[model samples]
Target: MHHLTGHRNIVELRGAYEDRHSVNLIMELCEGGELFDRIIARGHYSERAAALLCREMVSVVHSCHSMGVFHRDLKPENFLFLNNKEDSPLKATDFGLSVFFKHGEQFKDLVGSAYYVAPEVLKRHYGAEADIWSAGIILYILLSGVPPFWADHPWIREDGEAPDKPLDITVISRMKQFRAMNKLKKVALKIVAENLSEEEITGLKEMFRSLDTDNSGTITLEELRSGLPKLGTKISESEITQLMEAADVDGNGTIDYSEFVSATMHMNRLEKEDHILKAFEYFDKDHSGYITVDELEEALKKYDMGDDKTIKDIIAEVDTDHDGRINYQEFVAMMRNNSPEIVPNRRRMF
Candidate 1:
């Protein structure tokens, strides 16, 4: 807490204690709940507010990166409002996935929430630049009031293989290997997809204008369900069901405009934890509490497919202590320690 006290954008830490089974951290409670809640309550923010939020986040991330403390777990839930006020200042919180980097160091652990994780992380090698990718997703949510990866149904494969790539990227030179990403990964990449052209943006804006049926500068749930279906895409029934389930935070059958927007905006963050658990499962095939290079290879095979050598290279890089195998605890700690995308303003992460 003391190490984080002076940062203008970080939440103030009050006290902490370590219990036998868990560590308790007590920080200032966010009266505003989450930035996601605020965004949902207001349907969508004004352009100025969205821009302000993005700028502030960028500044915070910039500070973290400069200090070699990356906040890899940035999301709406991790962002708190100064208070419940409409114009409350926001602060970035949560350092569980944050990391500190040394010159020439490379981060190889796979951690962070699913929706916001960079593509490279899924491949098992990424750096601080991954955080910037997540930040971009947040900006998209603030402006669009919906996650970029919002899909209507779970695309389950009978063969248990991952899904084919659905996103288009401009900066990436190679994505042929991405076809093996799971349903969640395929969907998540849409937010960072580069396939969109200027004409597409204009078309999307037109669609948004049409969906803003009430001319309120926001699209309501009623409008979405009634009008968005007109898009002519064959969305899965299960997909819509999952979306509704995800959005109904109060357990109600229907989502209010705010609740709807808030849920979508935070969906990416929700996926992050799930991905970590999946990664753990990948290494714990026998339900054992440890990970072996063989298990890692099998897991990577799902994505690396024809490129088995690549998987071996990644395992060698992460086995920094040169142990023949990694225990679960070691893997977990390594993930917590090596996430380069998380930059915090507090103490350095190693």
Candidate 2:
């Protein structure tokens, strides 16, 4: 964090202190709020505005890499305006997932948030190029209000030549469904995390315990808001609510042990053959080598979100063949291209 000083876009880490169980840093404050909120409030985000935002975002990446730091997580939530002024600088914050690296060095850990993670990173071997890819994703979302990839569905061809037709769903509802898809990825990845290295996930147990400071076995919104500062995240109250709701998989308005694991784990860990195979096995309950709609519904039922319509929609999104079931090939295709809800109606603007 101290290494990011003297950069205009980065959130400066001024000082640090340690209390019994945690270390805290005094960070630069950006009271203007998150990048997404500003875009949504502006109503009409013009290409000119998007270009300026993209430049600032990209500049932050360049600065980080030039300083030998790899900011593994680059999402809209991490960018904030210095103030409510129209010309406030867009500051890049959140270095919790960052690491100092030498030139040509490769990192193997599954870091970064959903949608913004790069393909090579998912393969568990990637260099500074991955941060550039993440910045590109932010640029895409800056213009479209959504990322350009989602589950590698046919319509989401990585090339800039996908179909231009809009979905029958309205944009507002589409946003909601897109958020739903993001949560779905969390649930799916949680299953894979269970079989991963215990040491890799053991930290999460301590994380949950700290957030559940009351030892109540669940993390409330207040606890989450308080605990976030310890982890170097400075989020607005509204953003905290959104995050709490997203991570509260049980809809109980609190994060449980399992929900925290799901919400905190990286969604791109599906690149490993064994990891994906384990997830596929969970869906293919009958060992039929295919994931039927019934099986999907049953799998999602444990989370109480598996209505018939959702099952149909999920299959429609990933089932490339005319067949109703998702075969191993289709499943692999979807997992390999893990990403955000996309609308390919426009030409590549980023």
**Per-candidate total of colliding backbone pairs:** 16, 0
Query: TM per model?
Result: 0.45, 0.46
What are the per-residue Cα lDDT tens digits for candidate 1 across 1-350?
A: 34557677788788889989998888877676788666554435667989999998998888887777877788887899878877777888988878787544668888887567887888887788888999998888788655576222346432442233222111011121122223223222332222333432332343344455676755445655555455454545554455554434344465444433333222222223443445565556786655676776665455333245654655565455567666543444343334323422223122
Q: How far does residue 145 in candidate 2 sit from its true spot (Å)? A: 1.5
**TM accuracy, model 2:** 0.46
Report the C-alpha lDDT of model 2 over 215-249, residue by residue, as the tens digit: 89998999877766653434477866777777776
Top candidate, metric TM-score: 2
After superposition, which runs of candidate 2 have C-alpha atoms over 4 Å from their true positions? 152-350
Error of 1 at 248 (Å): 14
